[model samples]
Target: MRFNTAPAPHLAPTASTRRIMQWVLVAMAPGIAAQLWQFGPGVLINLALAIATALLTESAMLRLRAQPSRAGLSDWSAVLTAALLAVSLPPIAPWWISVFGALFAIVIGKQLYGGLGYNPFNPAMVGYAVLLISFPKPMTAWLPPTDLAATPLGLLDAWSAIAHRAGPAGSSFDALAMATPLDTLKTQLGLGRTMDEVQSGPLFGALAGKGWQWVNLGYLAGGLWLLRRGLIAWQIPAGFLAALGGLSLGFYLLEPQTYPTPLFHLFAGATMLGAFFIATDPVTASTTPKGRLIYGALIGGLVFVIRSWGGYPDGVAFAVLLLNLAAPTIDHYTRPRVYGHPG
Candidate 1:
């Protein structure tokens, strides 16, 4: 008997890359709006600068590589990368900072390795990590949340601060600047302060820091929207949050004086953003279902370790990059057995 030999199990149609990226961008809107509401026009200004720079850089790189820029530009990957990097940056960061980061993200992080799907690391996180390491002071100089500021910063003030690195009249940079919740916690812990005493300050809010909880909630909401729309896989965020919460809870329970609560870790800094947006990058994240779980758990564990013990206050960028490097290996070992085949 003659048997027809052909590829088995044809997959059904799925969303196009452009559509997926569009959904991702839509999901980011709430988080961006929250940042704008909480911080001021700096968020918008930074995003504008980053997006402009990213598009320019992407165009230049595509031209140099002799690839058509139309599809690349239309994909919205570069725009999303710029947006993520902008959000990671300090609200009042100089224009040059945004320009440099966006250019690097597109040209070096994405295009250098043949663009998009070929890049092994999360391009936005790579840009963020480089800026953090190279320009430590500027990168770490976050503005005081609006509610916590003695004088709430206006759009004009944010513009001036970014333009010339100066706050409004009668206000020094020191007056406008405040350490992030993670940074404050690390500093206070280094100074032998207990968790309770550290959190008693006005910096601490109902859960995380002032304004930050709302920001985190906004991201969480957006992330849930993405999940509901099937834009992202569920395993990664689930594993990430579970592992992080478990580790943090254990530490807090063991020594409440020394460790902050799991909820604080969950709602503070960039935890939600990193878990939902950064670590779920389809190009760089583990592809297999089981691999994704392992990848996310690794990132989560590393984040807790670095936040608690390492030099950096928040380790989202570092953790994501590290796990990105391991994604291929994770995928290799976690591949599911073919149907009707032996494991």
Candidate 2:
């Protein structure tokens, strides 16, 4: 009898990294659209710059390593990293910011260690952390939501603001930039103000903040889609949200005048985005089911700690990077035993 078996991998692959990356980009659409509606074209402008720079840097790195550029580029990991880093930046950040960030993300964060899955840290988060540490002022120059902006710029004017060019009718870039809702709350809390007093501002919308709730919801919706499609593990997001919300509820209940509501914490900053998209990154996250829950919970706890007391208003990036360092250890301890093996 003739055997029909080839080499290994007799079953065809159900998914590719490229395909997964494409789905991630698609999942980001709603959140991106919300940002555009709230802050205008700054995100798009930065995204274009970051993508171009990431591709160039990736190509150069691939050539240096004597690898096929098309295979690397077609994988879409570079694009996703670029998009994530670009989106995380302040909308009015200068063009050089995105360019520099993309360079760092692809070259140092990813390729320096061999590229893609080889890198231990999330490339986008690395770029973001570096930018945050290096350029604190520019990194925090977020524009207020359109309704709250005193002089909201049009698409051309937004580009001009990013370009450091004078806006139409002498509108200034500084006029548009302000603290994010999270920053505002943090500052007010530092100043010993009650939640009720802080919530009176236009910055605080019905749920979280002006435009922020919708952005978080959009991401949550996209995240749900990915879950349904089986592209990501539910344990990570579930554990993250549960811990964050649970902690927030505890603090808020203890001092209603001090801490904000659980919904505010859930819908604020990068909570949903980090929980759904960033924390669930398969490479930096744990492999085992139980390990993932512990990993995500630790991240969530660190986020709460940082936001409550640390310097940064949002701690998602830092939390994720810190947790990335522990993923291997978590997997080691949580590894399942063989069915027939004795302890």
Candidate 3:
């Protein structure tokens, strides 16, 4: 018998890092568009400044680490990180604020931990948390939706607001700022207001905030698309939303006057964003099939607990970061048994 010789074995990954990052960026377009439609031109300004800062910082870090800058930059992890952090921020924040956050995200949150997959926590959330802690005032200085604002800011006005060197009509930054719906709700609840009284303002619409609910819907559309494309597993998102919704529903049913509607909790603030995008981060989330569910549920539960009782108005970033710290432990215990391993 004649033996046929074959070439040496080769390795090829089905989806490269660049491709994966591209998908993620594409998935964000709808959410970003929804935000722009509702908020105004400020989001665009924030995104531009943030992407620029992220790329610059990523390049610098790669150089310092003696890594190939081109390869690192091409993967677009920096871009995604910057975008997530940007969206989480108040759109009217100064350009320098975004620059600082992007720099911190790329450097301390990523490179300092050996970059990308090696980082135990989410880089974007780290930057966001740091900014929230350091610059509490500006971080919470959100603007009302364009339709709600008495004077909807034009592109130039947005530019002036973000630059902080000039004002559209000699008005201070605070003049254009308004509290977010979540912030308003928390303040009202603290003042001993009923849920009905708290959500009576124009800021509160059908479900969540006036313009914010649509943004969450847009993100949901994108997330469903990502799921259909098999880019992300459904277990995590399902577990997260289910846990949050279940818990919120229980409370709302018990004391509707004290608690906001369950829909409000589901569609408000960053709940959808965290469930679909942030908490689902593969590098920082649990890997095992069972572990993913537990991991996601833990994040959801923490979000509820913190939002109801903690200092922050929204808890998605904090919840995700906290769970990222426990992901390894979750995966270890929940790992699937080997095909031939004994029970």
Candidate 4:
């Protein structure tokens, strides 16, 4: 009798990667629904493009490497990577943006490092970082909330905007696009405006930004379910949110006029998604329990620092990538004690 061998970076000893990826995809449904309601059909468009591109790219790469495409394509890792990257993108970005980003993610970020569990960085984040660096304008070309846009985009309108790289007929891209809440706040504070003044602006919402609070809530709900299902560990998200919220609270209390509130930080920009979905990536994240907390807290700290001082508005992707490099060190120092061994 012969047993088949598989690749590295498996989610767990008990769970197959396909099942884990399925749960993750299911977990994102509510968030995707929120995105559609708030931002229009851009998420779906990007997701379609990314999923297609990632699958094809991964298939080709597998064949080139003489690996079985059936084993890989069935695992759903590529699909999960694409979904994460797709949702992170500007909803109405050019069609090529998703295609190119997904290609790079599967080709370089994952396969180049020998695929799946062997890759140190999160493939989705690697794609996002490259896109942000190479195509900053398109990456940041975000549509305002459905209620805020001059013309609300239907499915065909979204398809048109993505394909043509402009807004619907008679509307300019400028009418549809706006800076995200994090960006707006960063710019306003730089201009010496008070937080109150900024919060009263059209883009600001009750908790975070218009449409953003609900989206975060949607993801938060799914994340909690994931926690309950034991698909993900509790330490990572807890430490991440706790540290981010703690830091935001300290700064907001110190200078309420200068900083956005903890609620804003928690609900705006990719805080919940990054904390729950992205940081909980088993392959790239810390393996040891204590290390997971430290890893998460450090990522949270980096996110705050980058948002406040770094060039980017949101720092989740960069924060995750940075710590991906440090995961080994963290796990080394945080390893649990051996039951029978003592110093």
lDDT digits (tens) for residues 289-325 of candidate 4: 9999999999999999999899999999999999999
lDDT of 2 by residue, 96-165 (tens): 9999999999998999999888999999999999999999988998888877876666778878878874
Q: How does model 2 score by TM-score?
A: 0.97
For 1-343, candidate 3 gives per-residue lDDT tens digits of: 9988767655556888889889988998898998988888889898998899999999989999999999999999999999999998888898888999999988999999999899999999999999999999889988888669888778999888898745568877777888888888888999999998888888999989988898898899889988998899998999889988988999989999887877998888998789888999989999999999999999898988887888988899999999999999999999898999974
In model 1, the Cα lDDT at residue 267 comes to 94
Compare the candidates by lDDT and give the number of the best one. Answer: 4
Q: Can you give the lDDT of residue 64 in candidate 1?
A: 96
lDDT of 4: 0.93
TM-score of each candidate structure, all chains considered together: 0.95, 0.97, 0.96, 0.95
Candidate 1 has what TM-score? 0.95
Residue pairs in clash, model 3: none
Number of clashing pairs per prediction, in order: 0, 0, 0, 1
Candidate 2, 41: how far from true, in Å? 0.8
Off by over 4 Å in 1: 1-14
RMSD of 1: 3.0
Point out where model 2 deviates above 4 Å. Answer: none
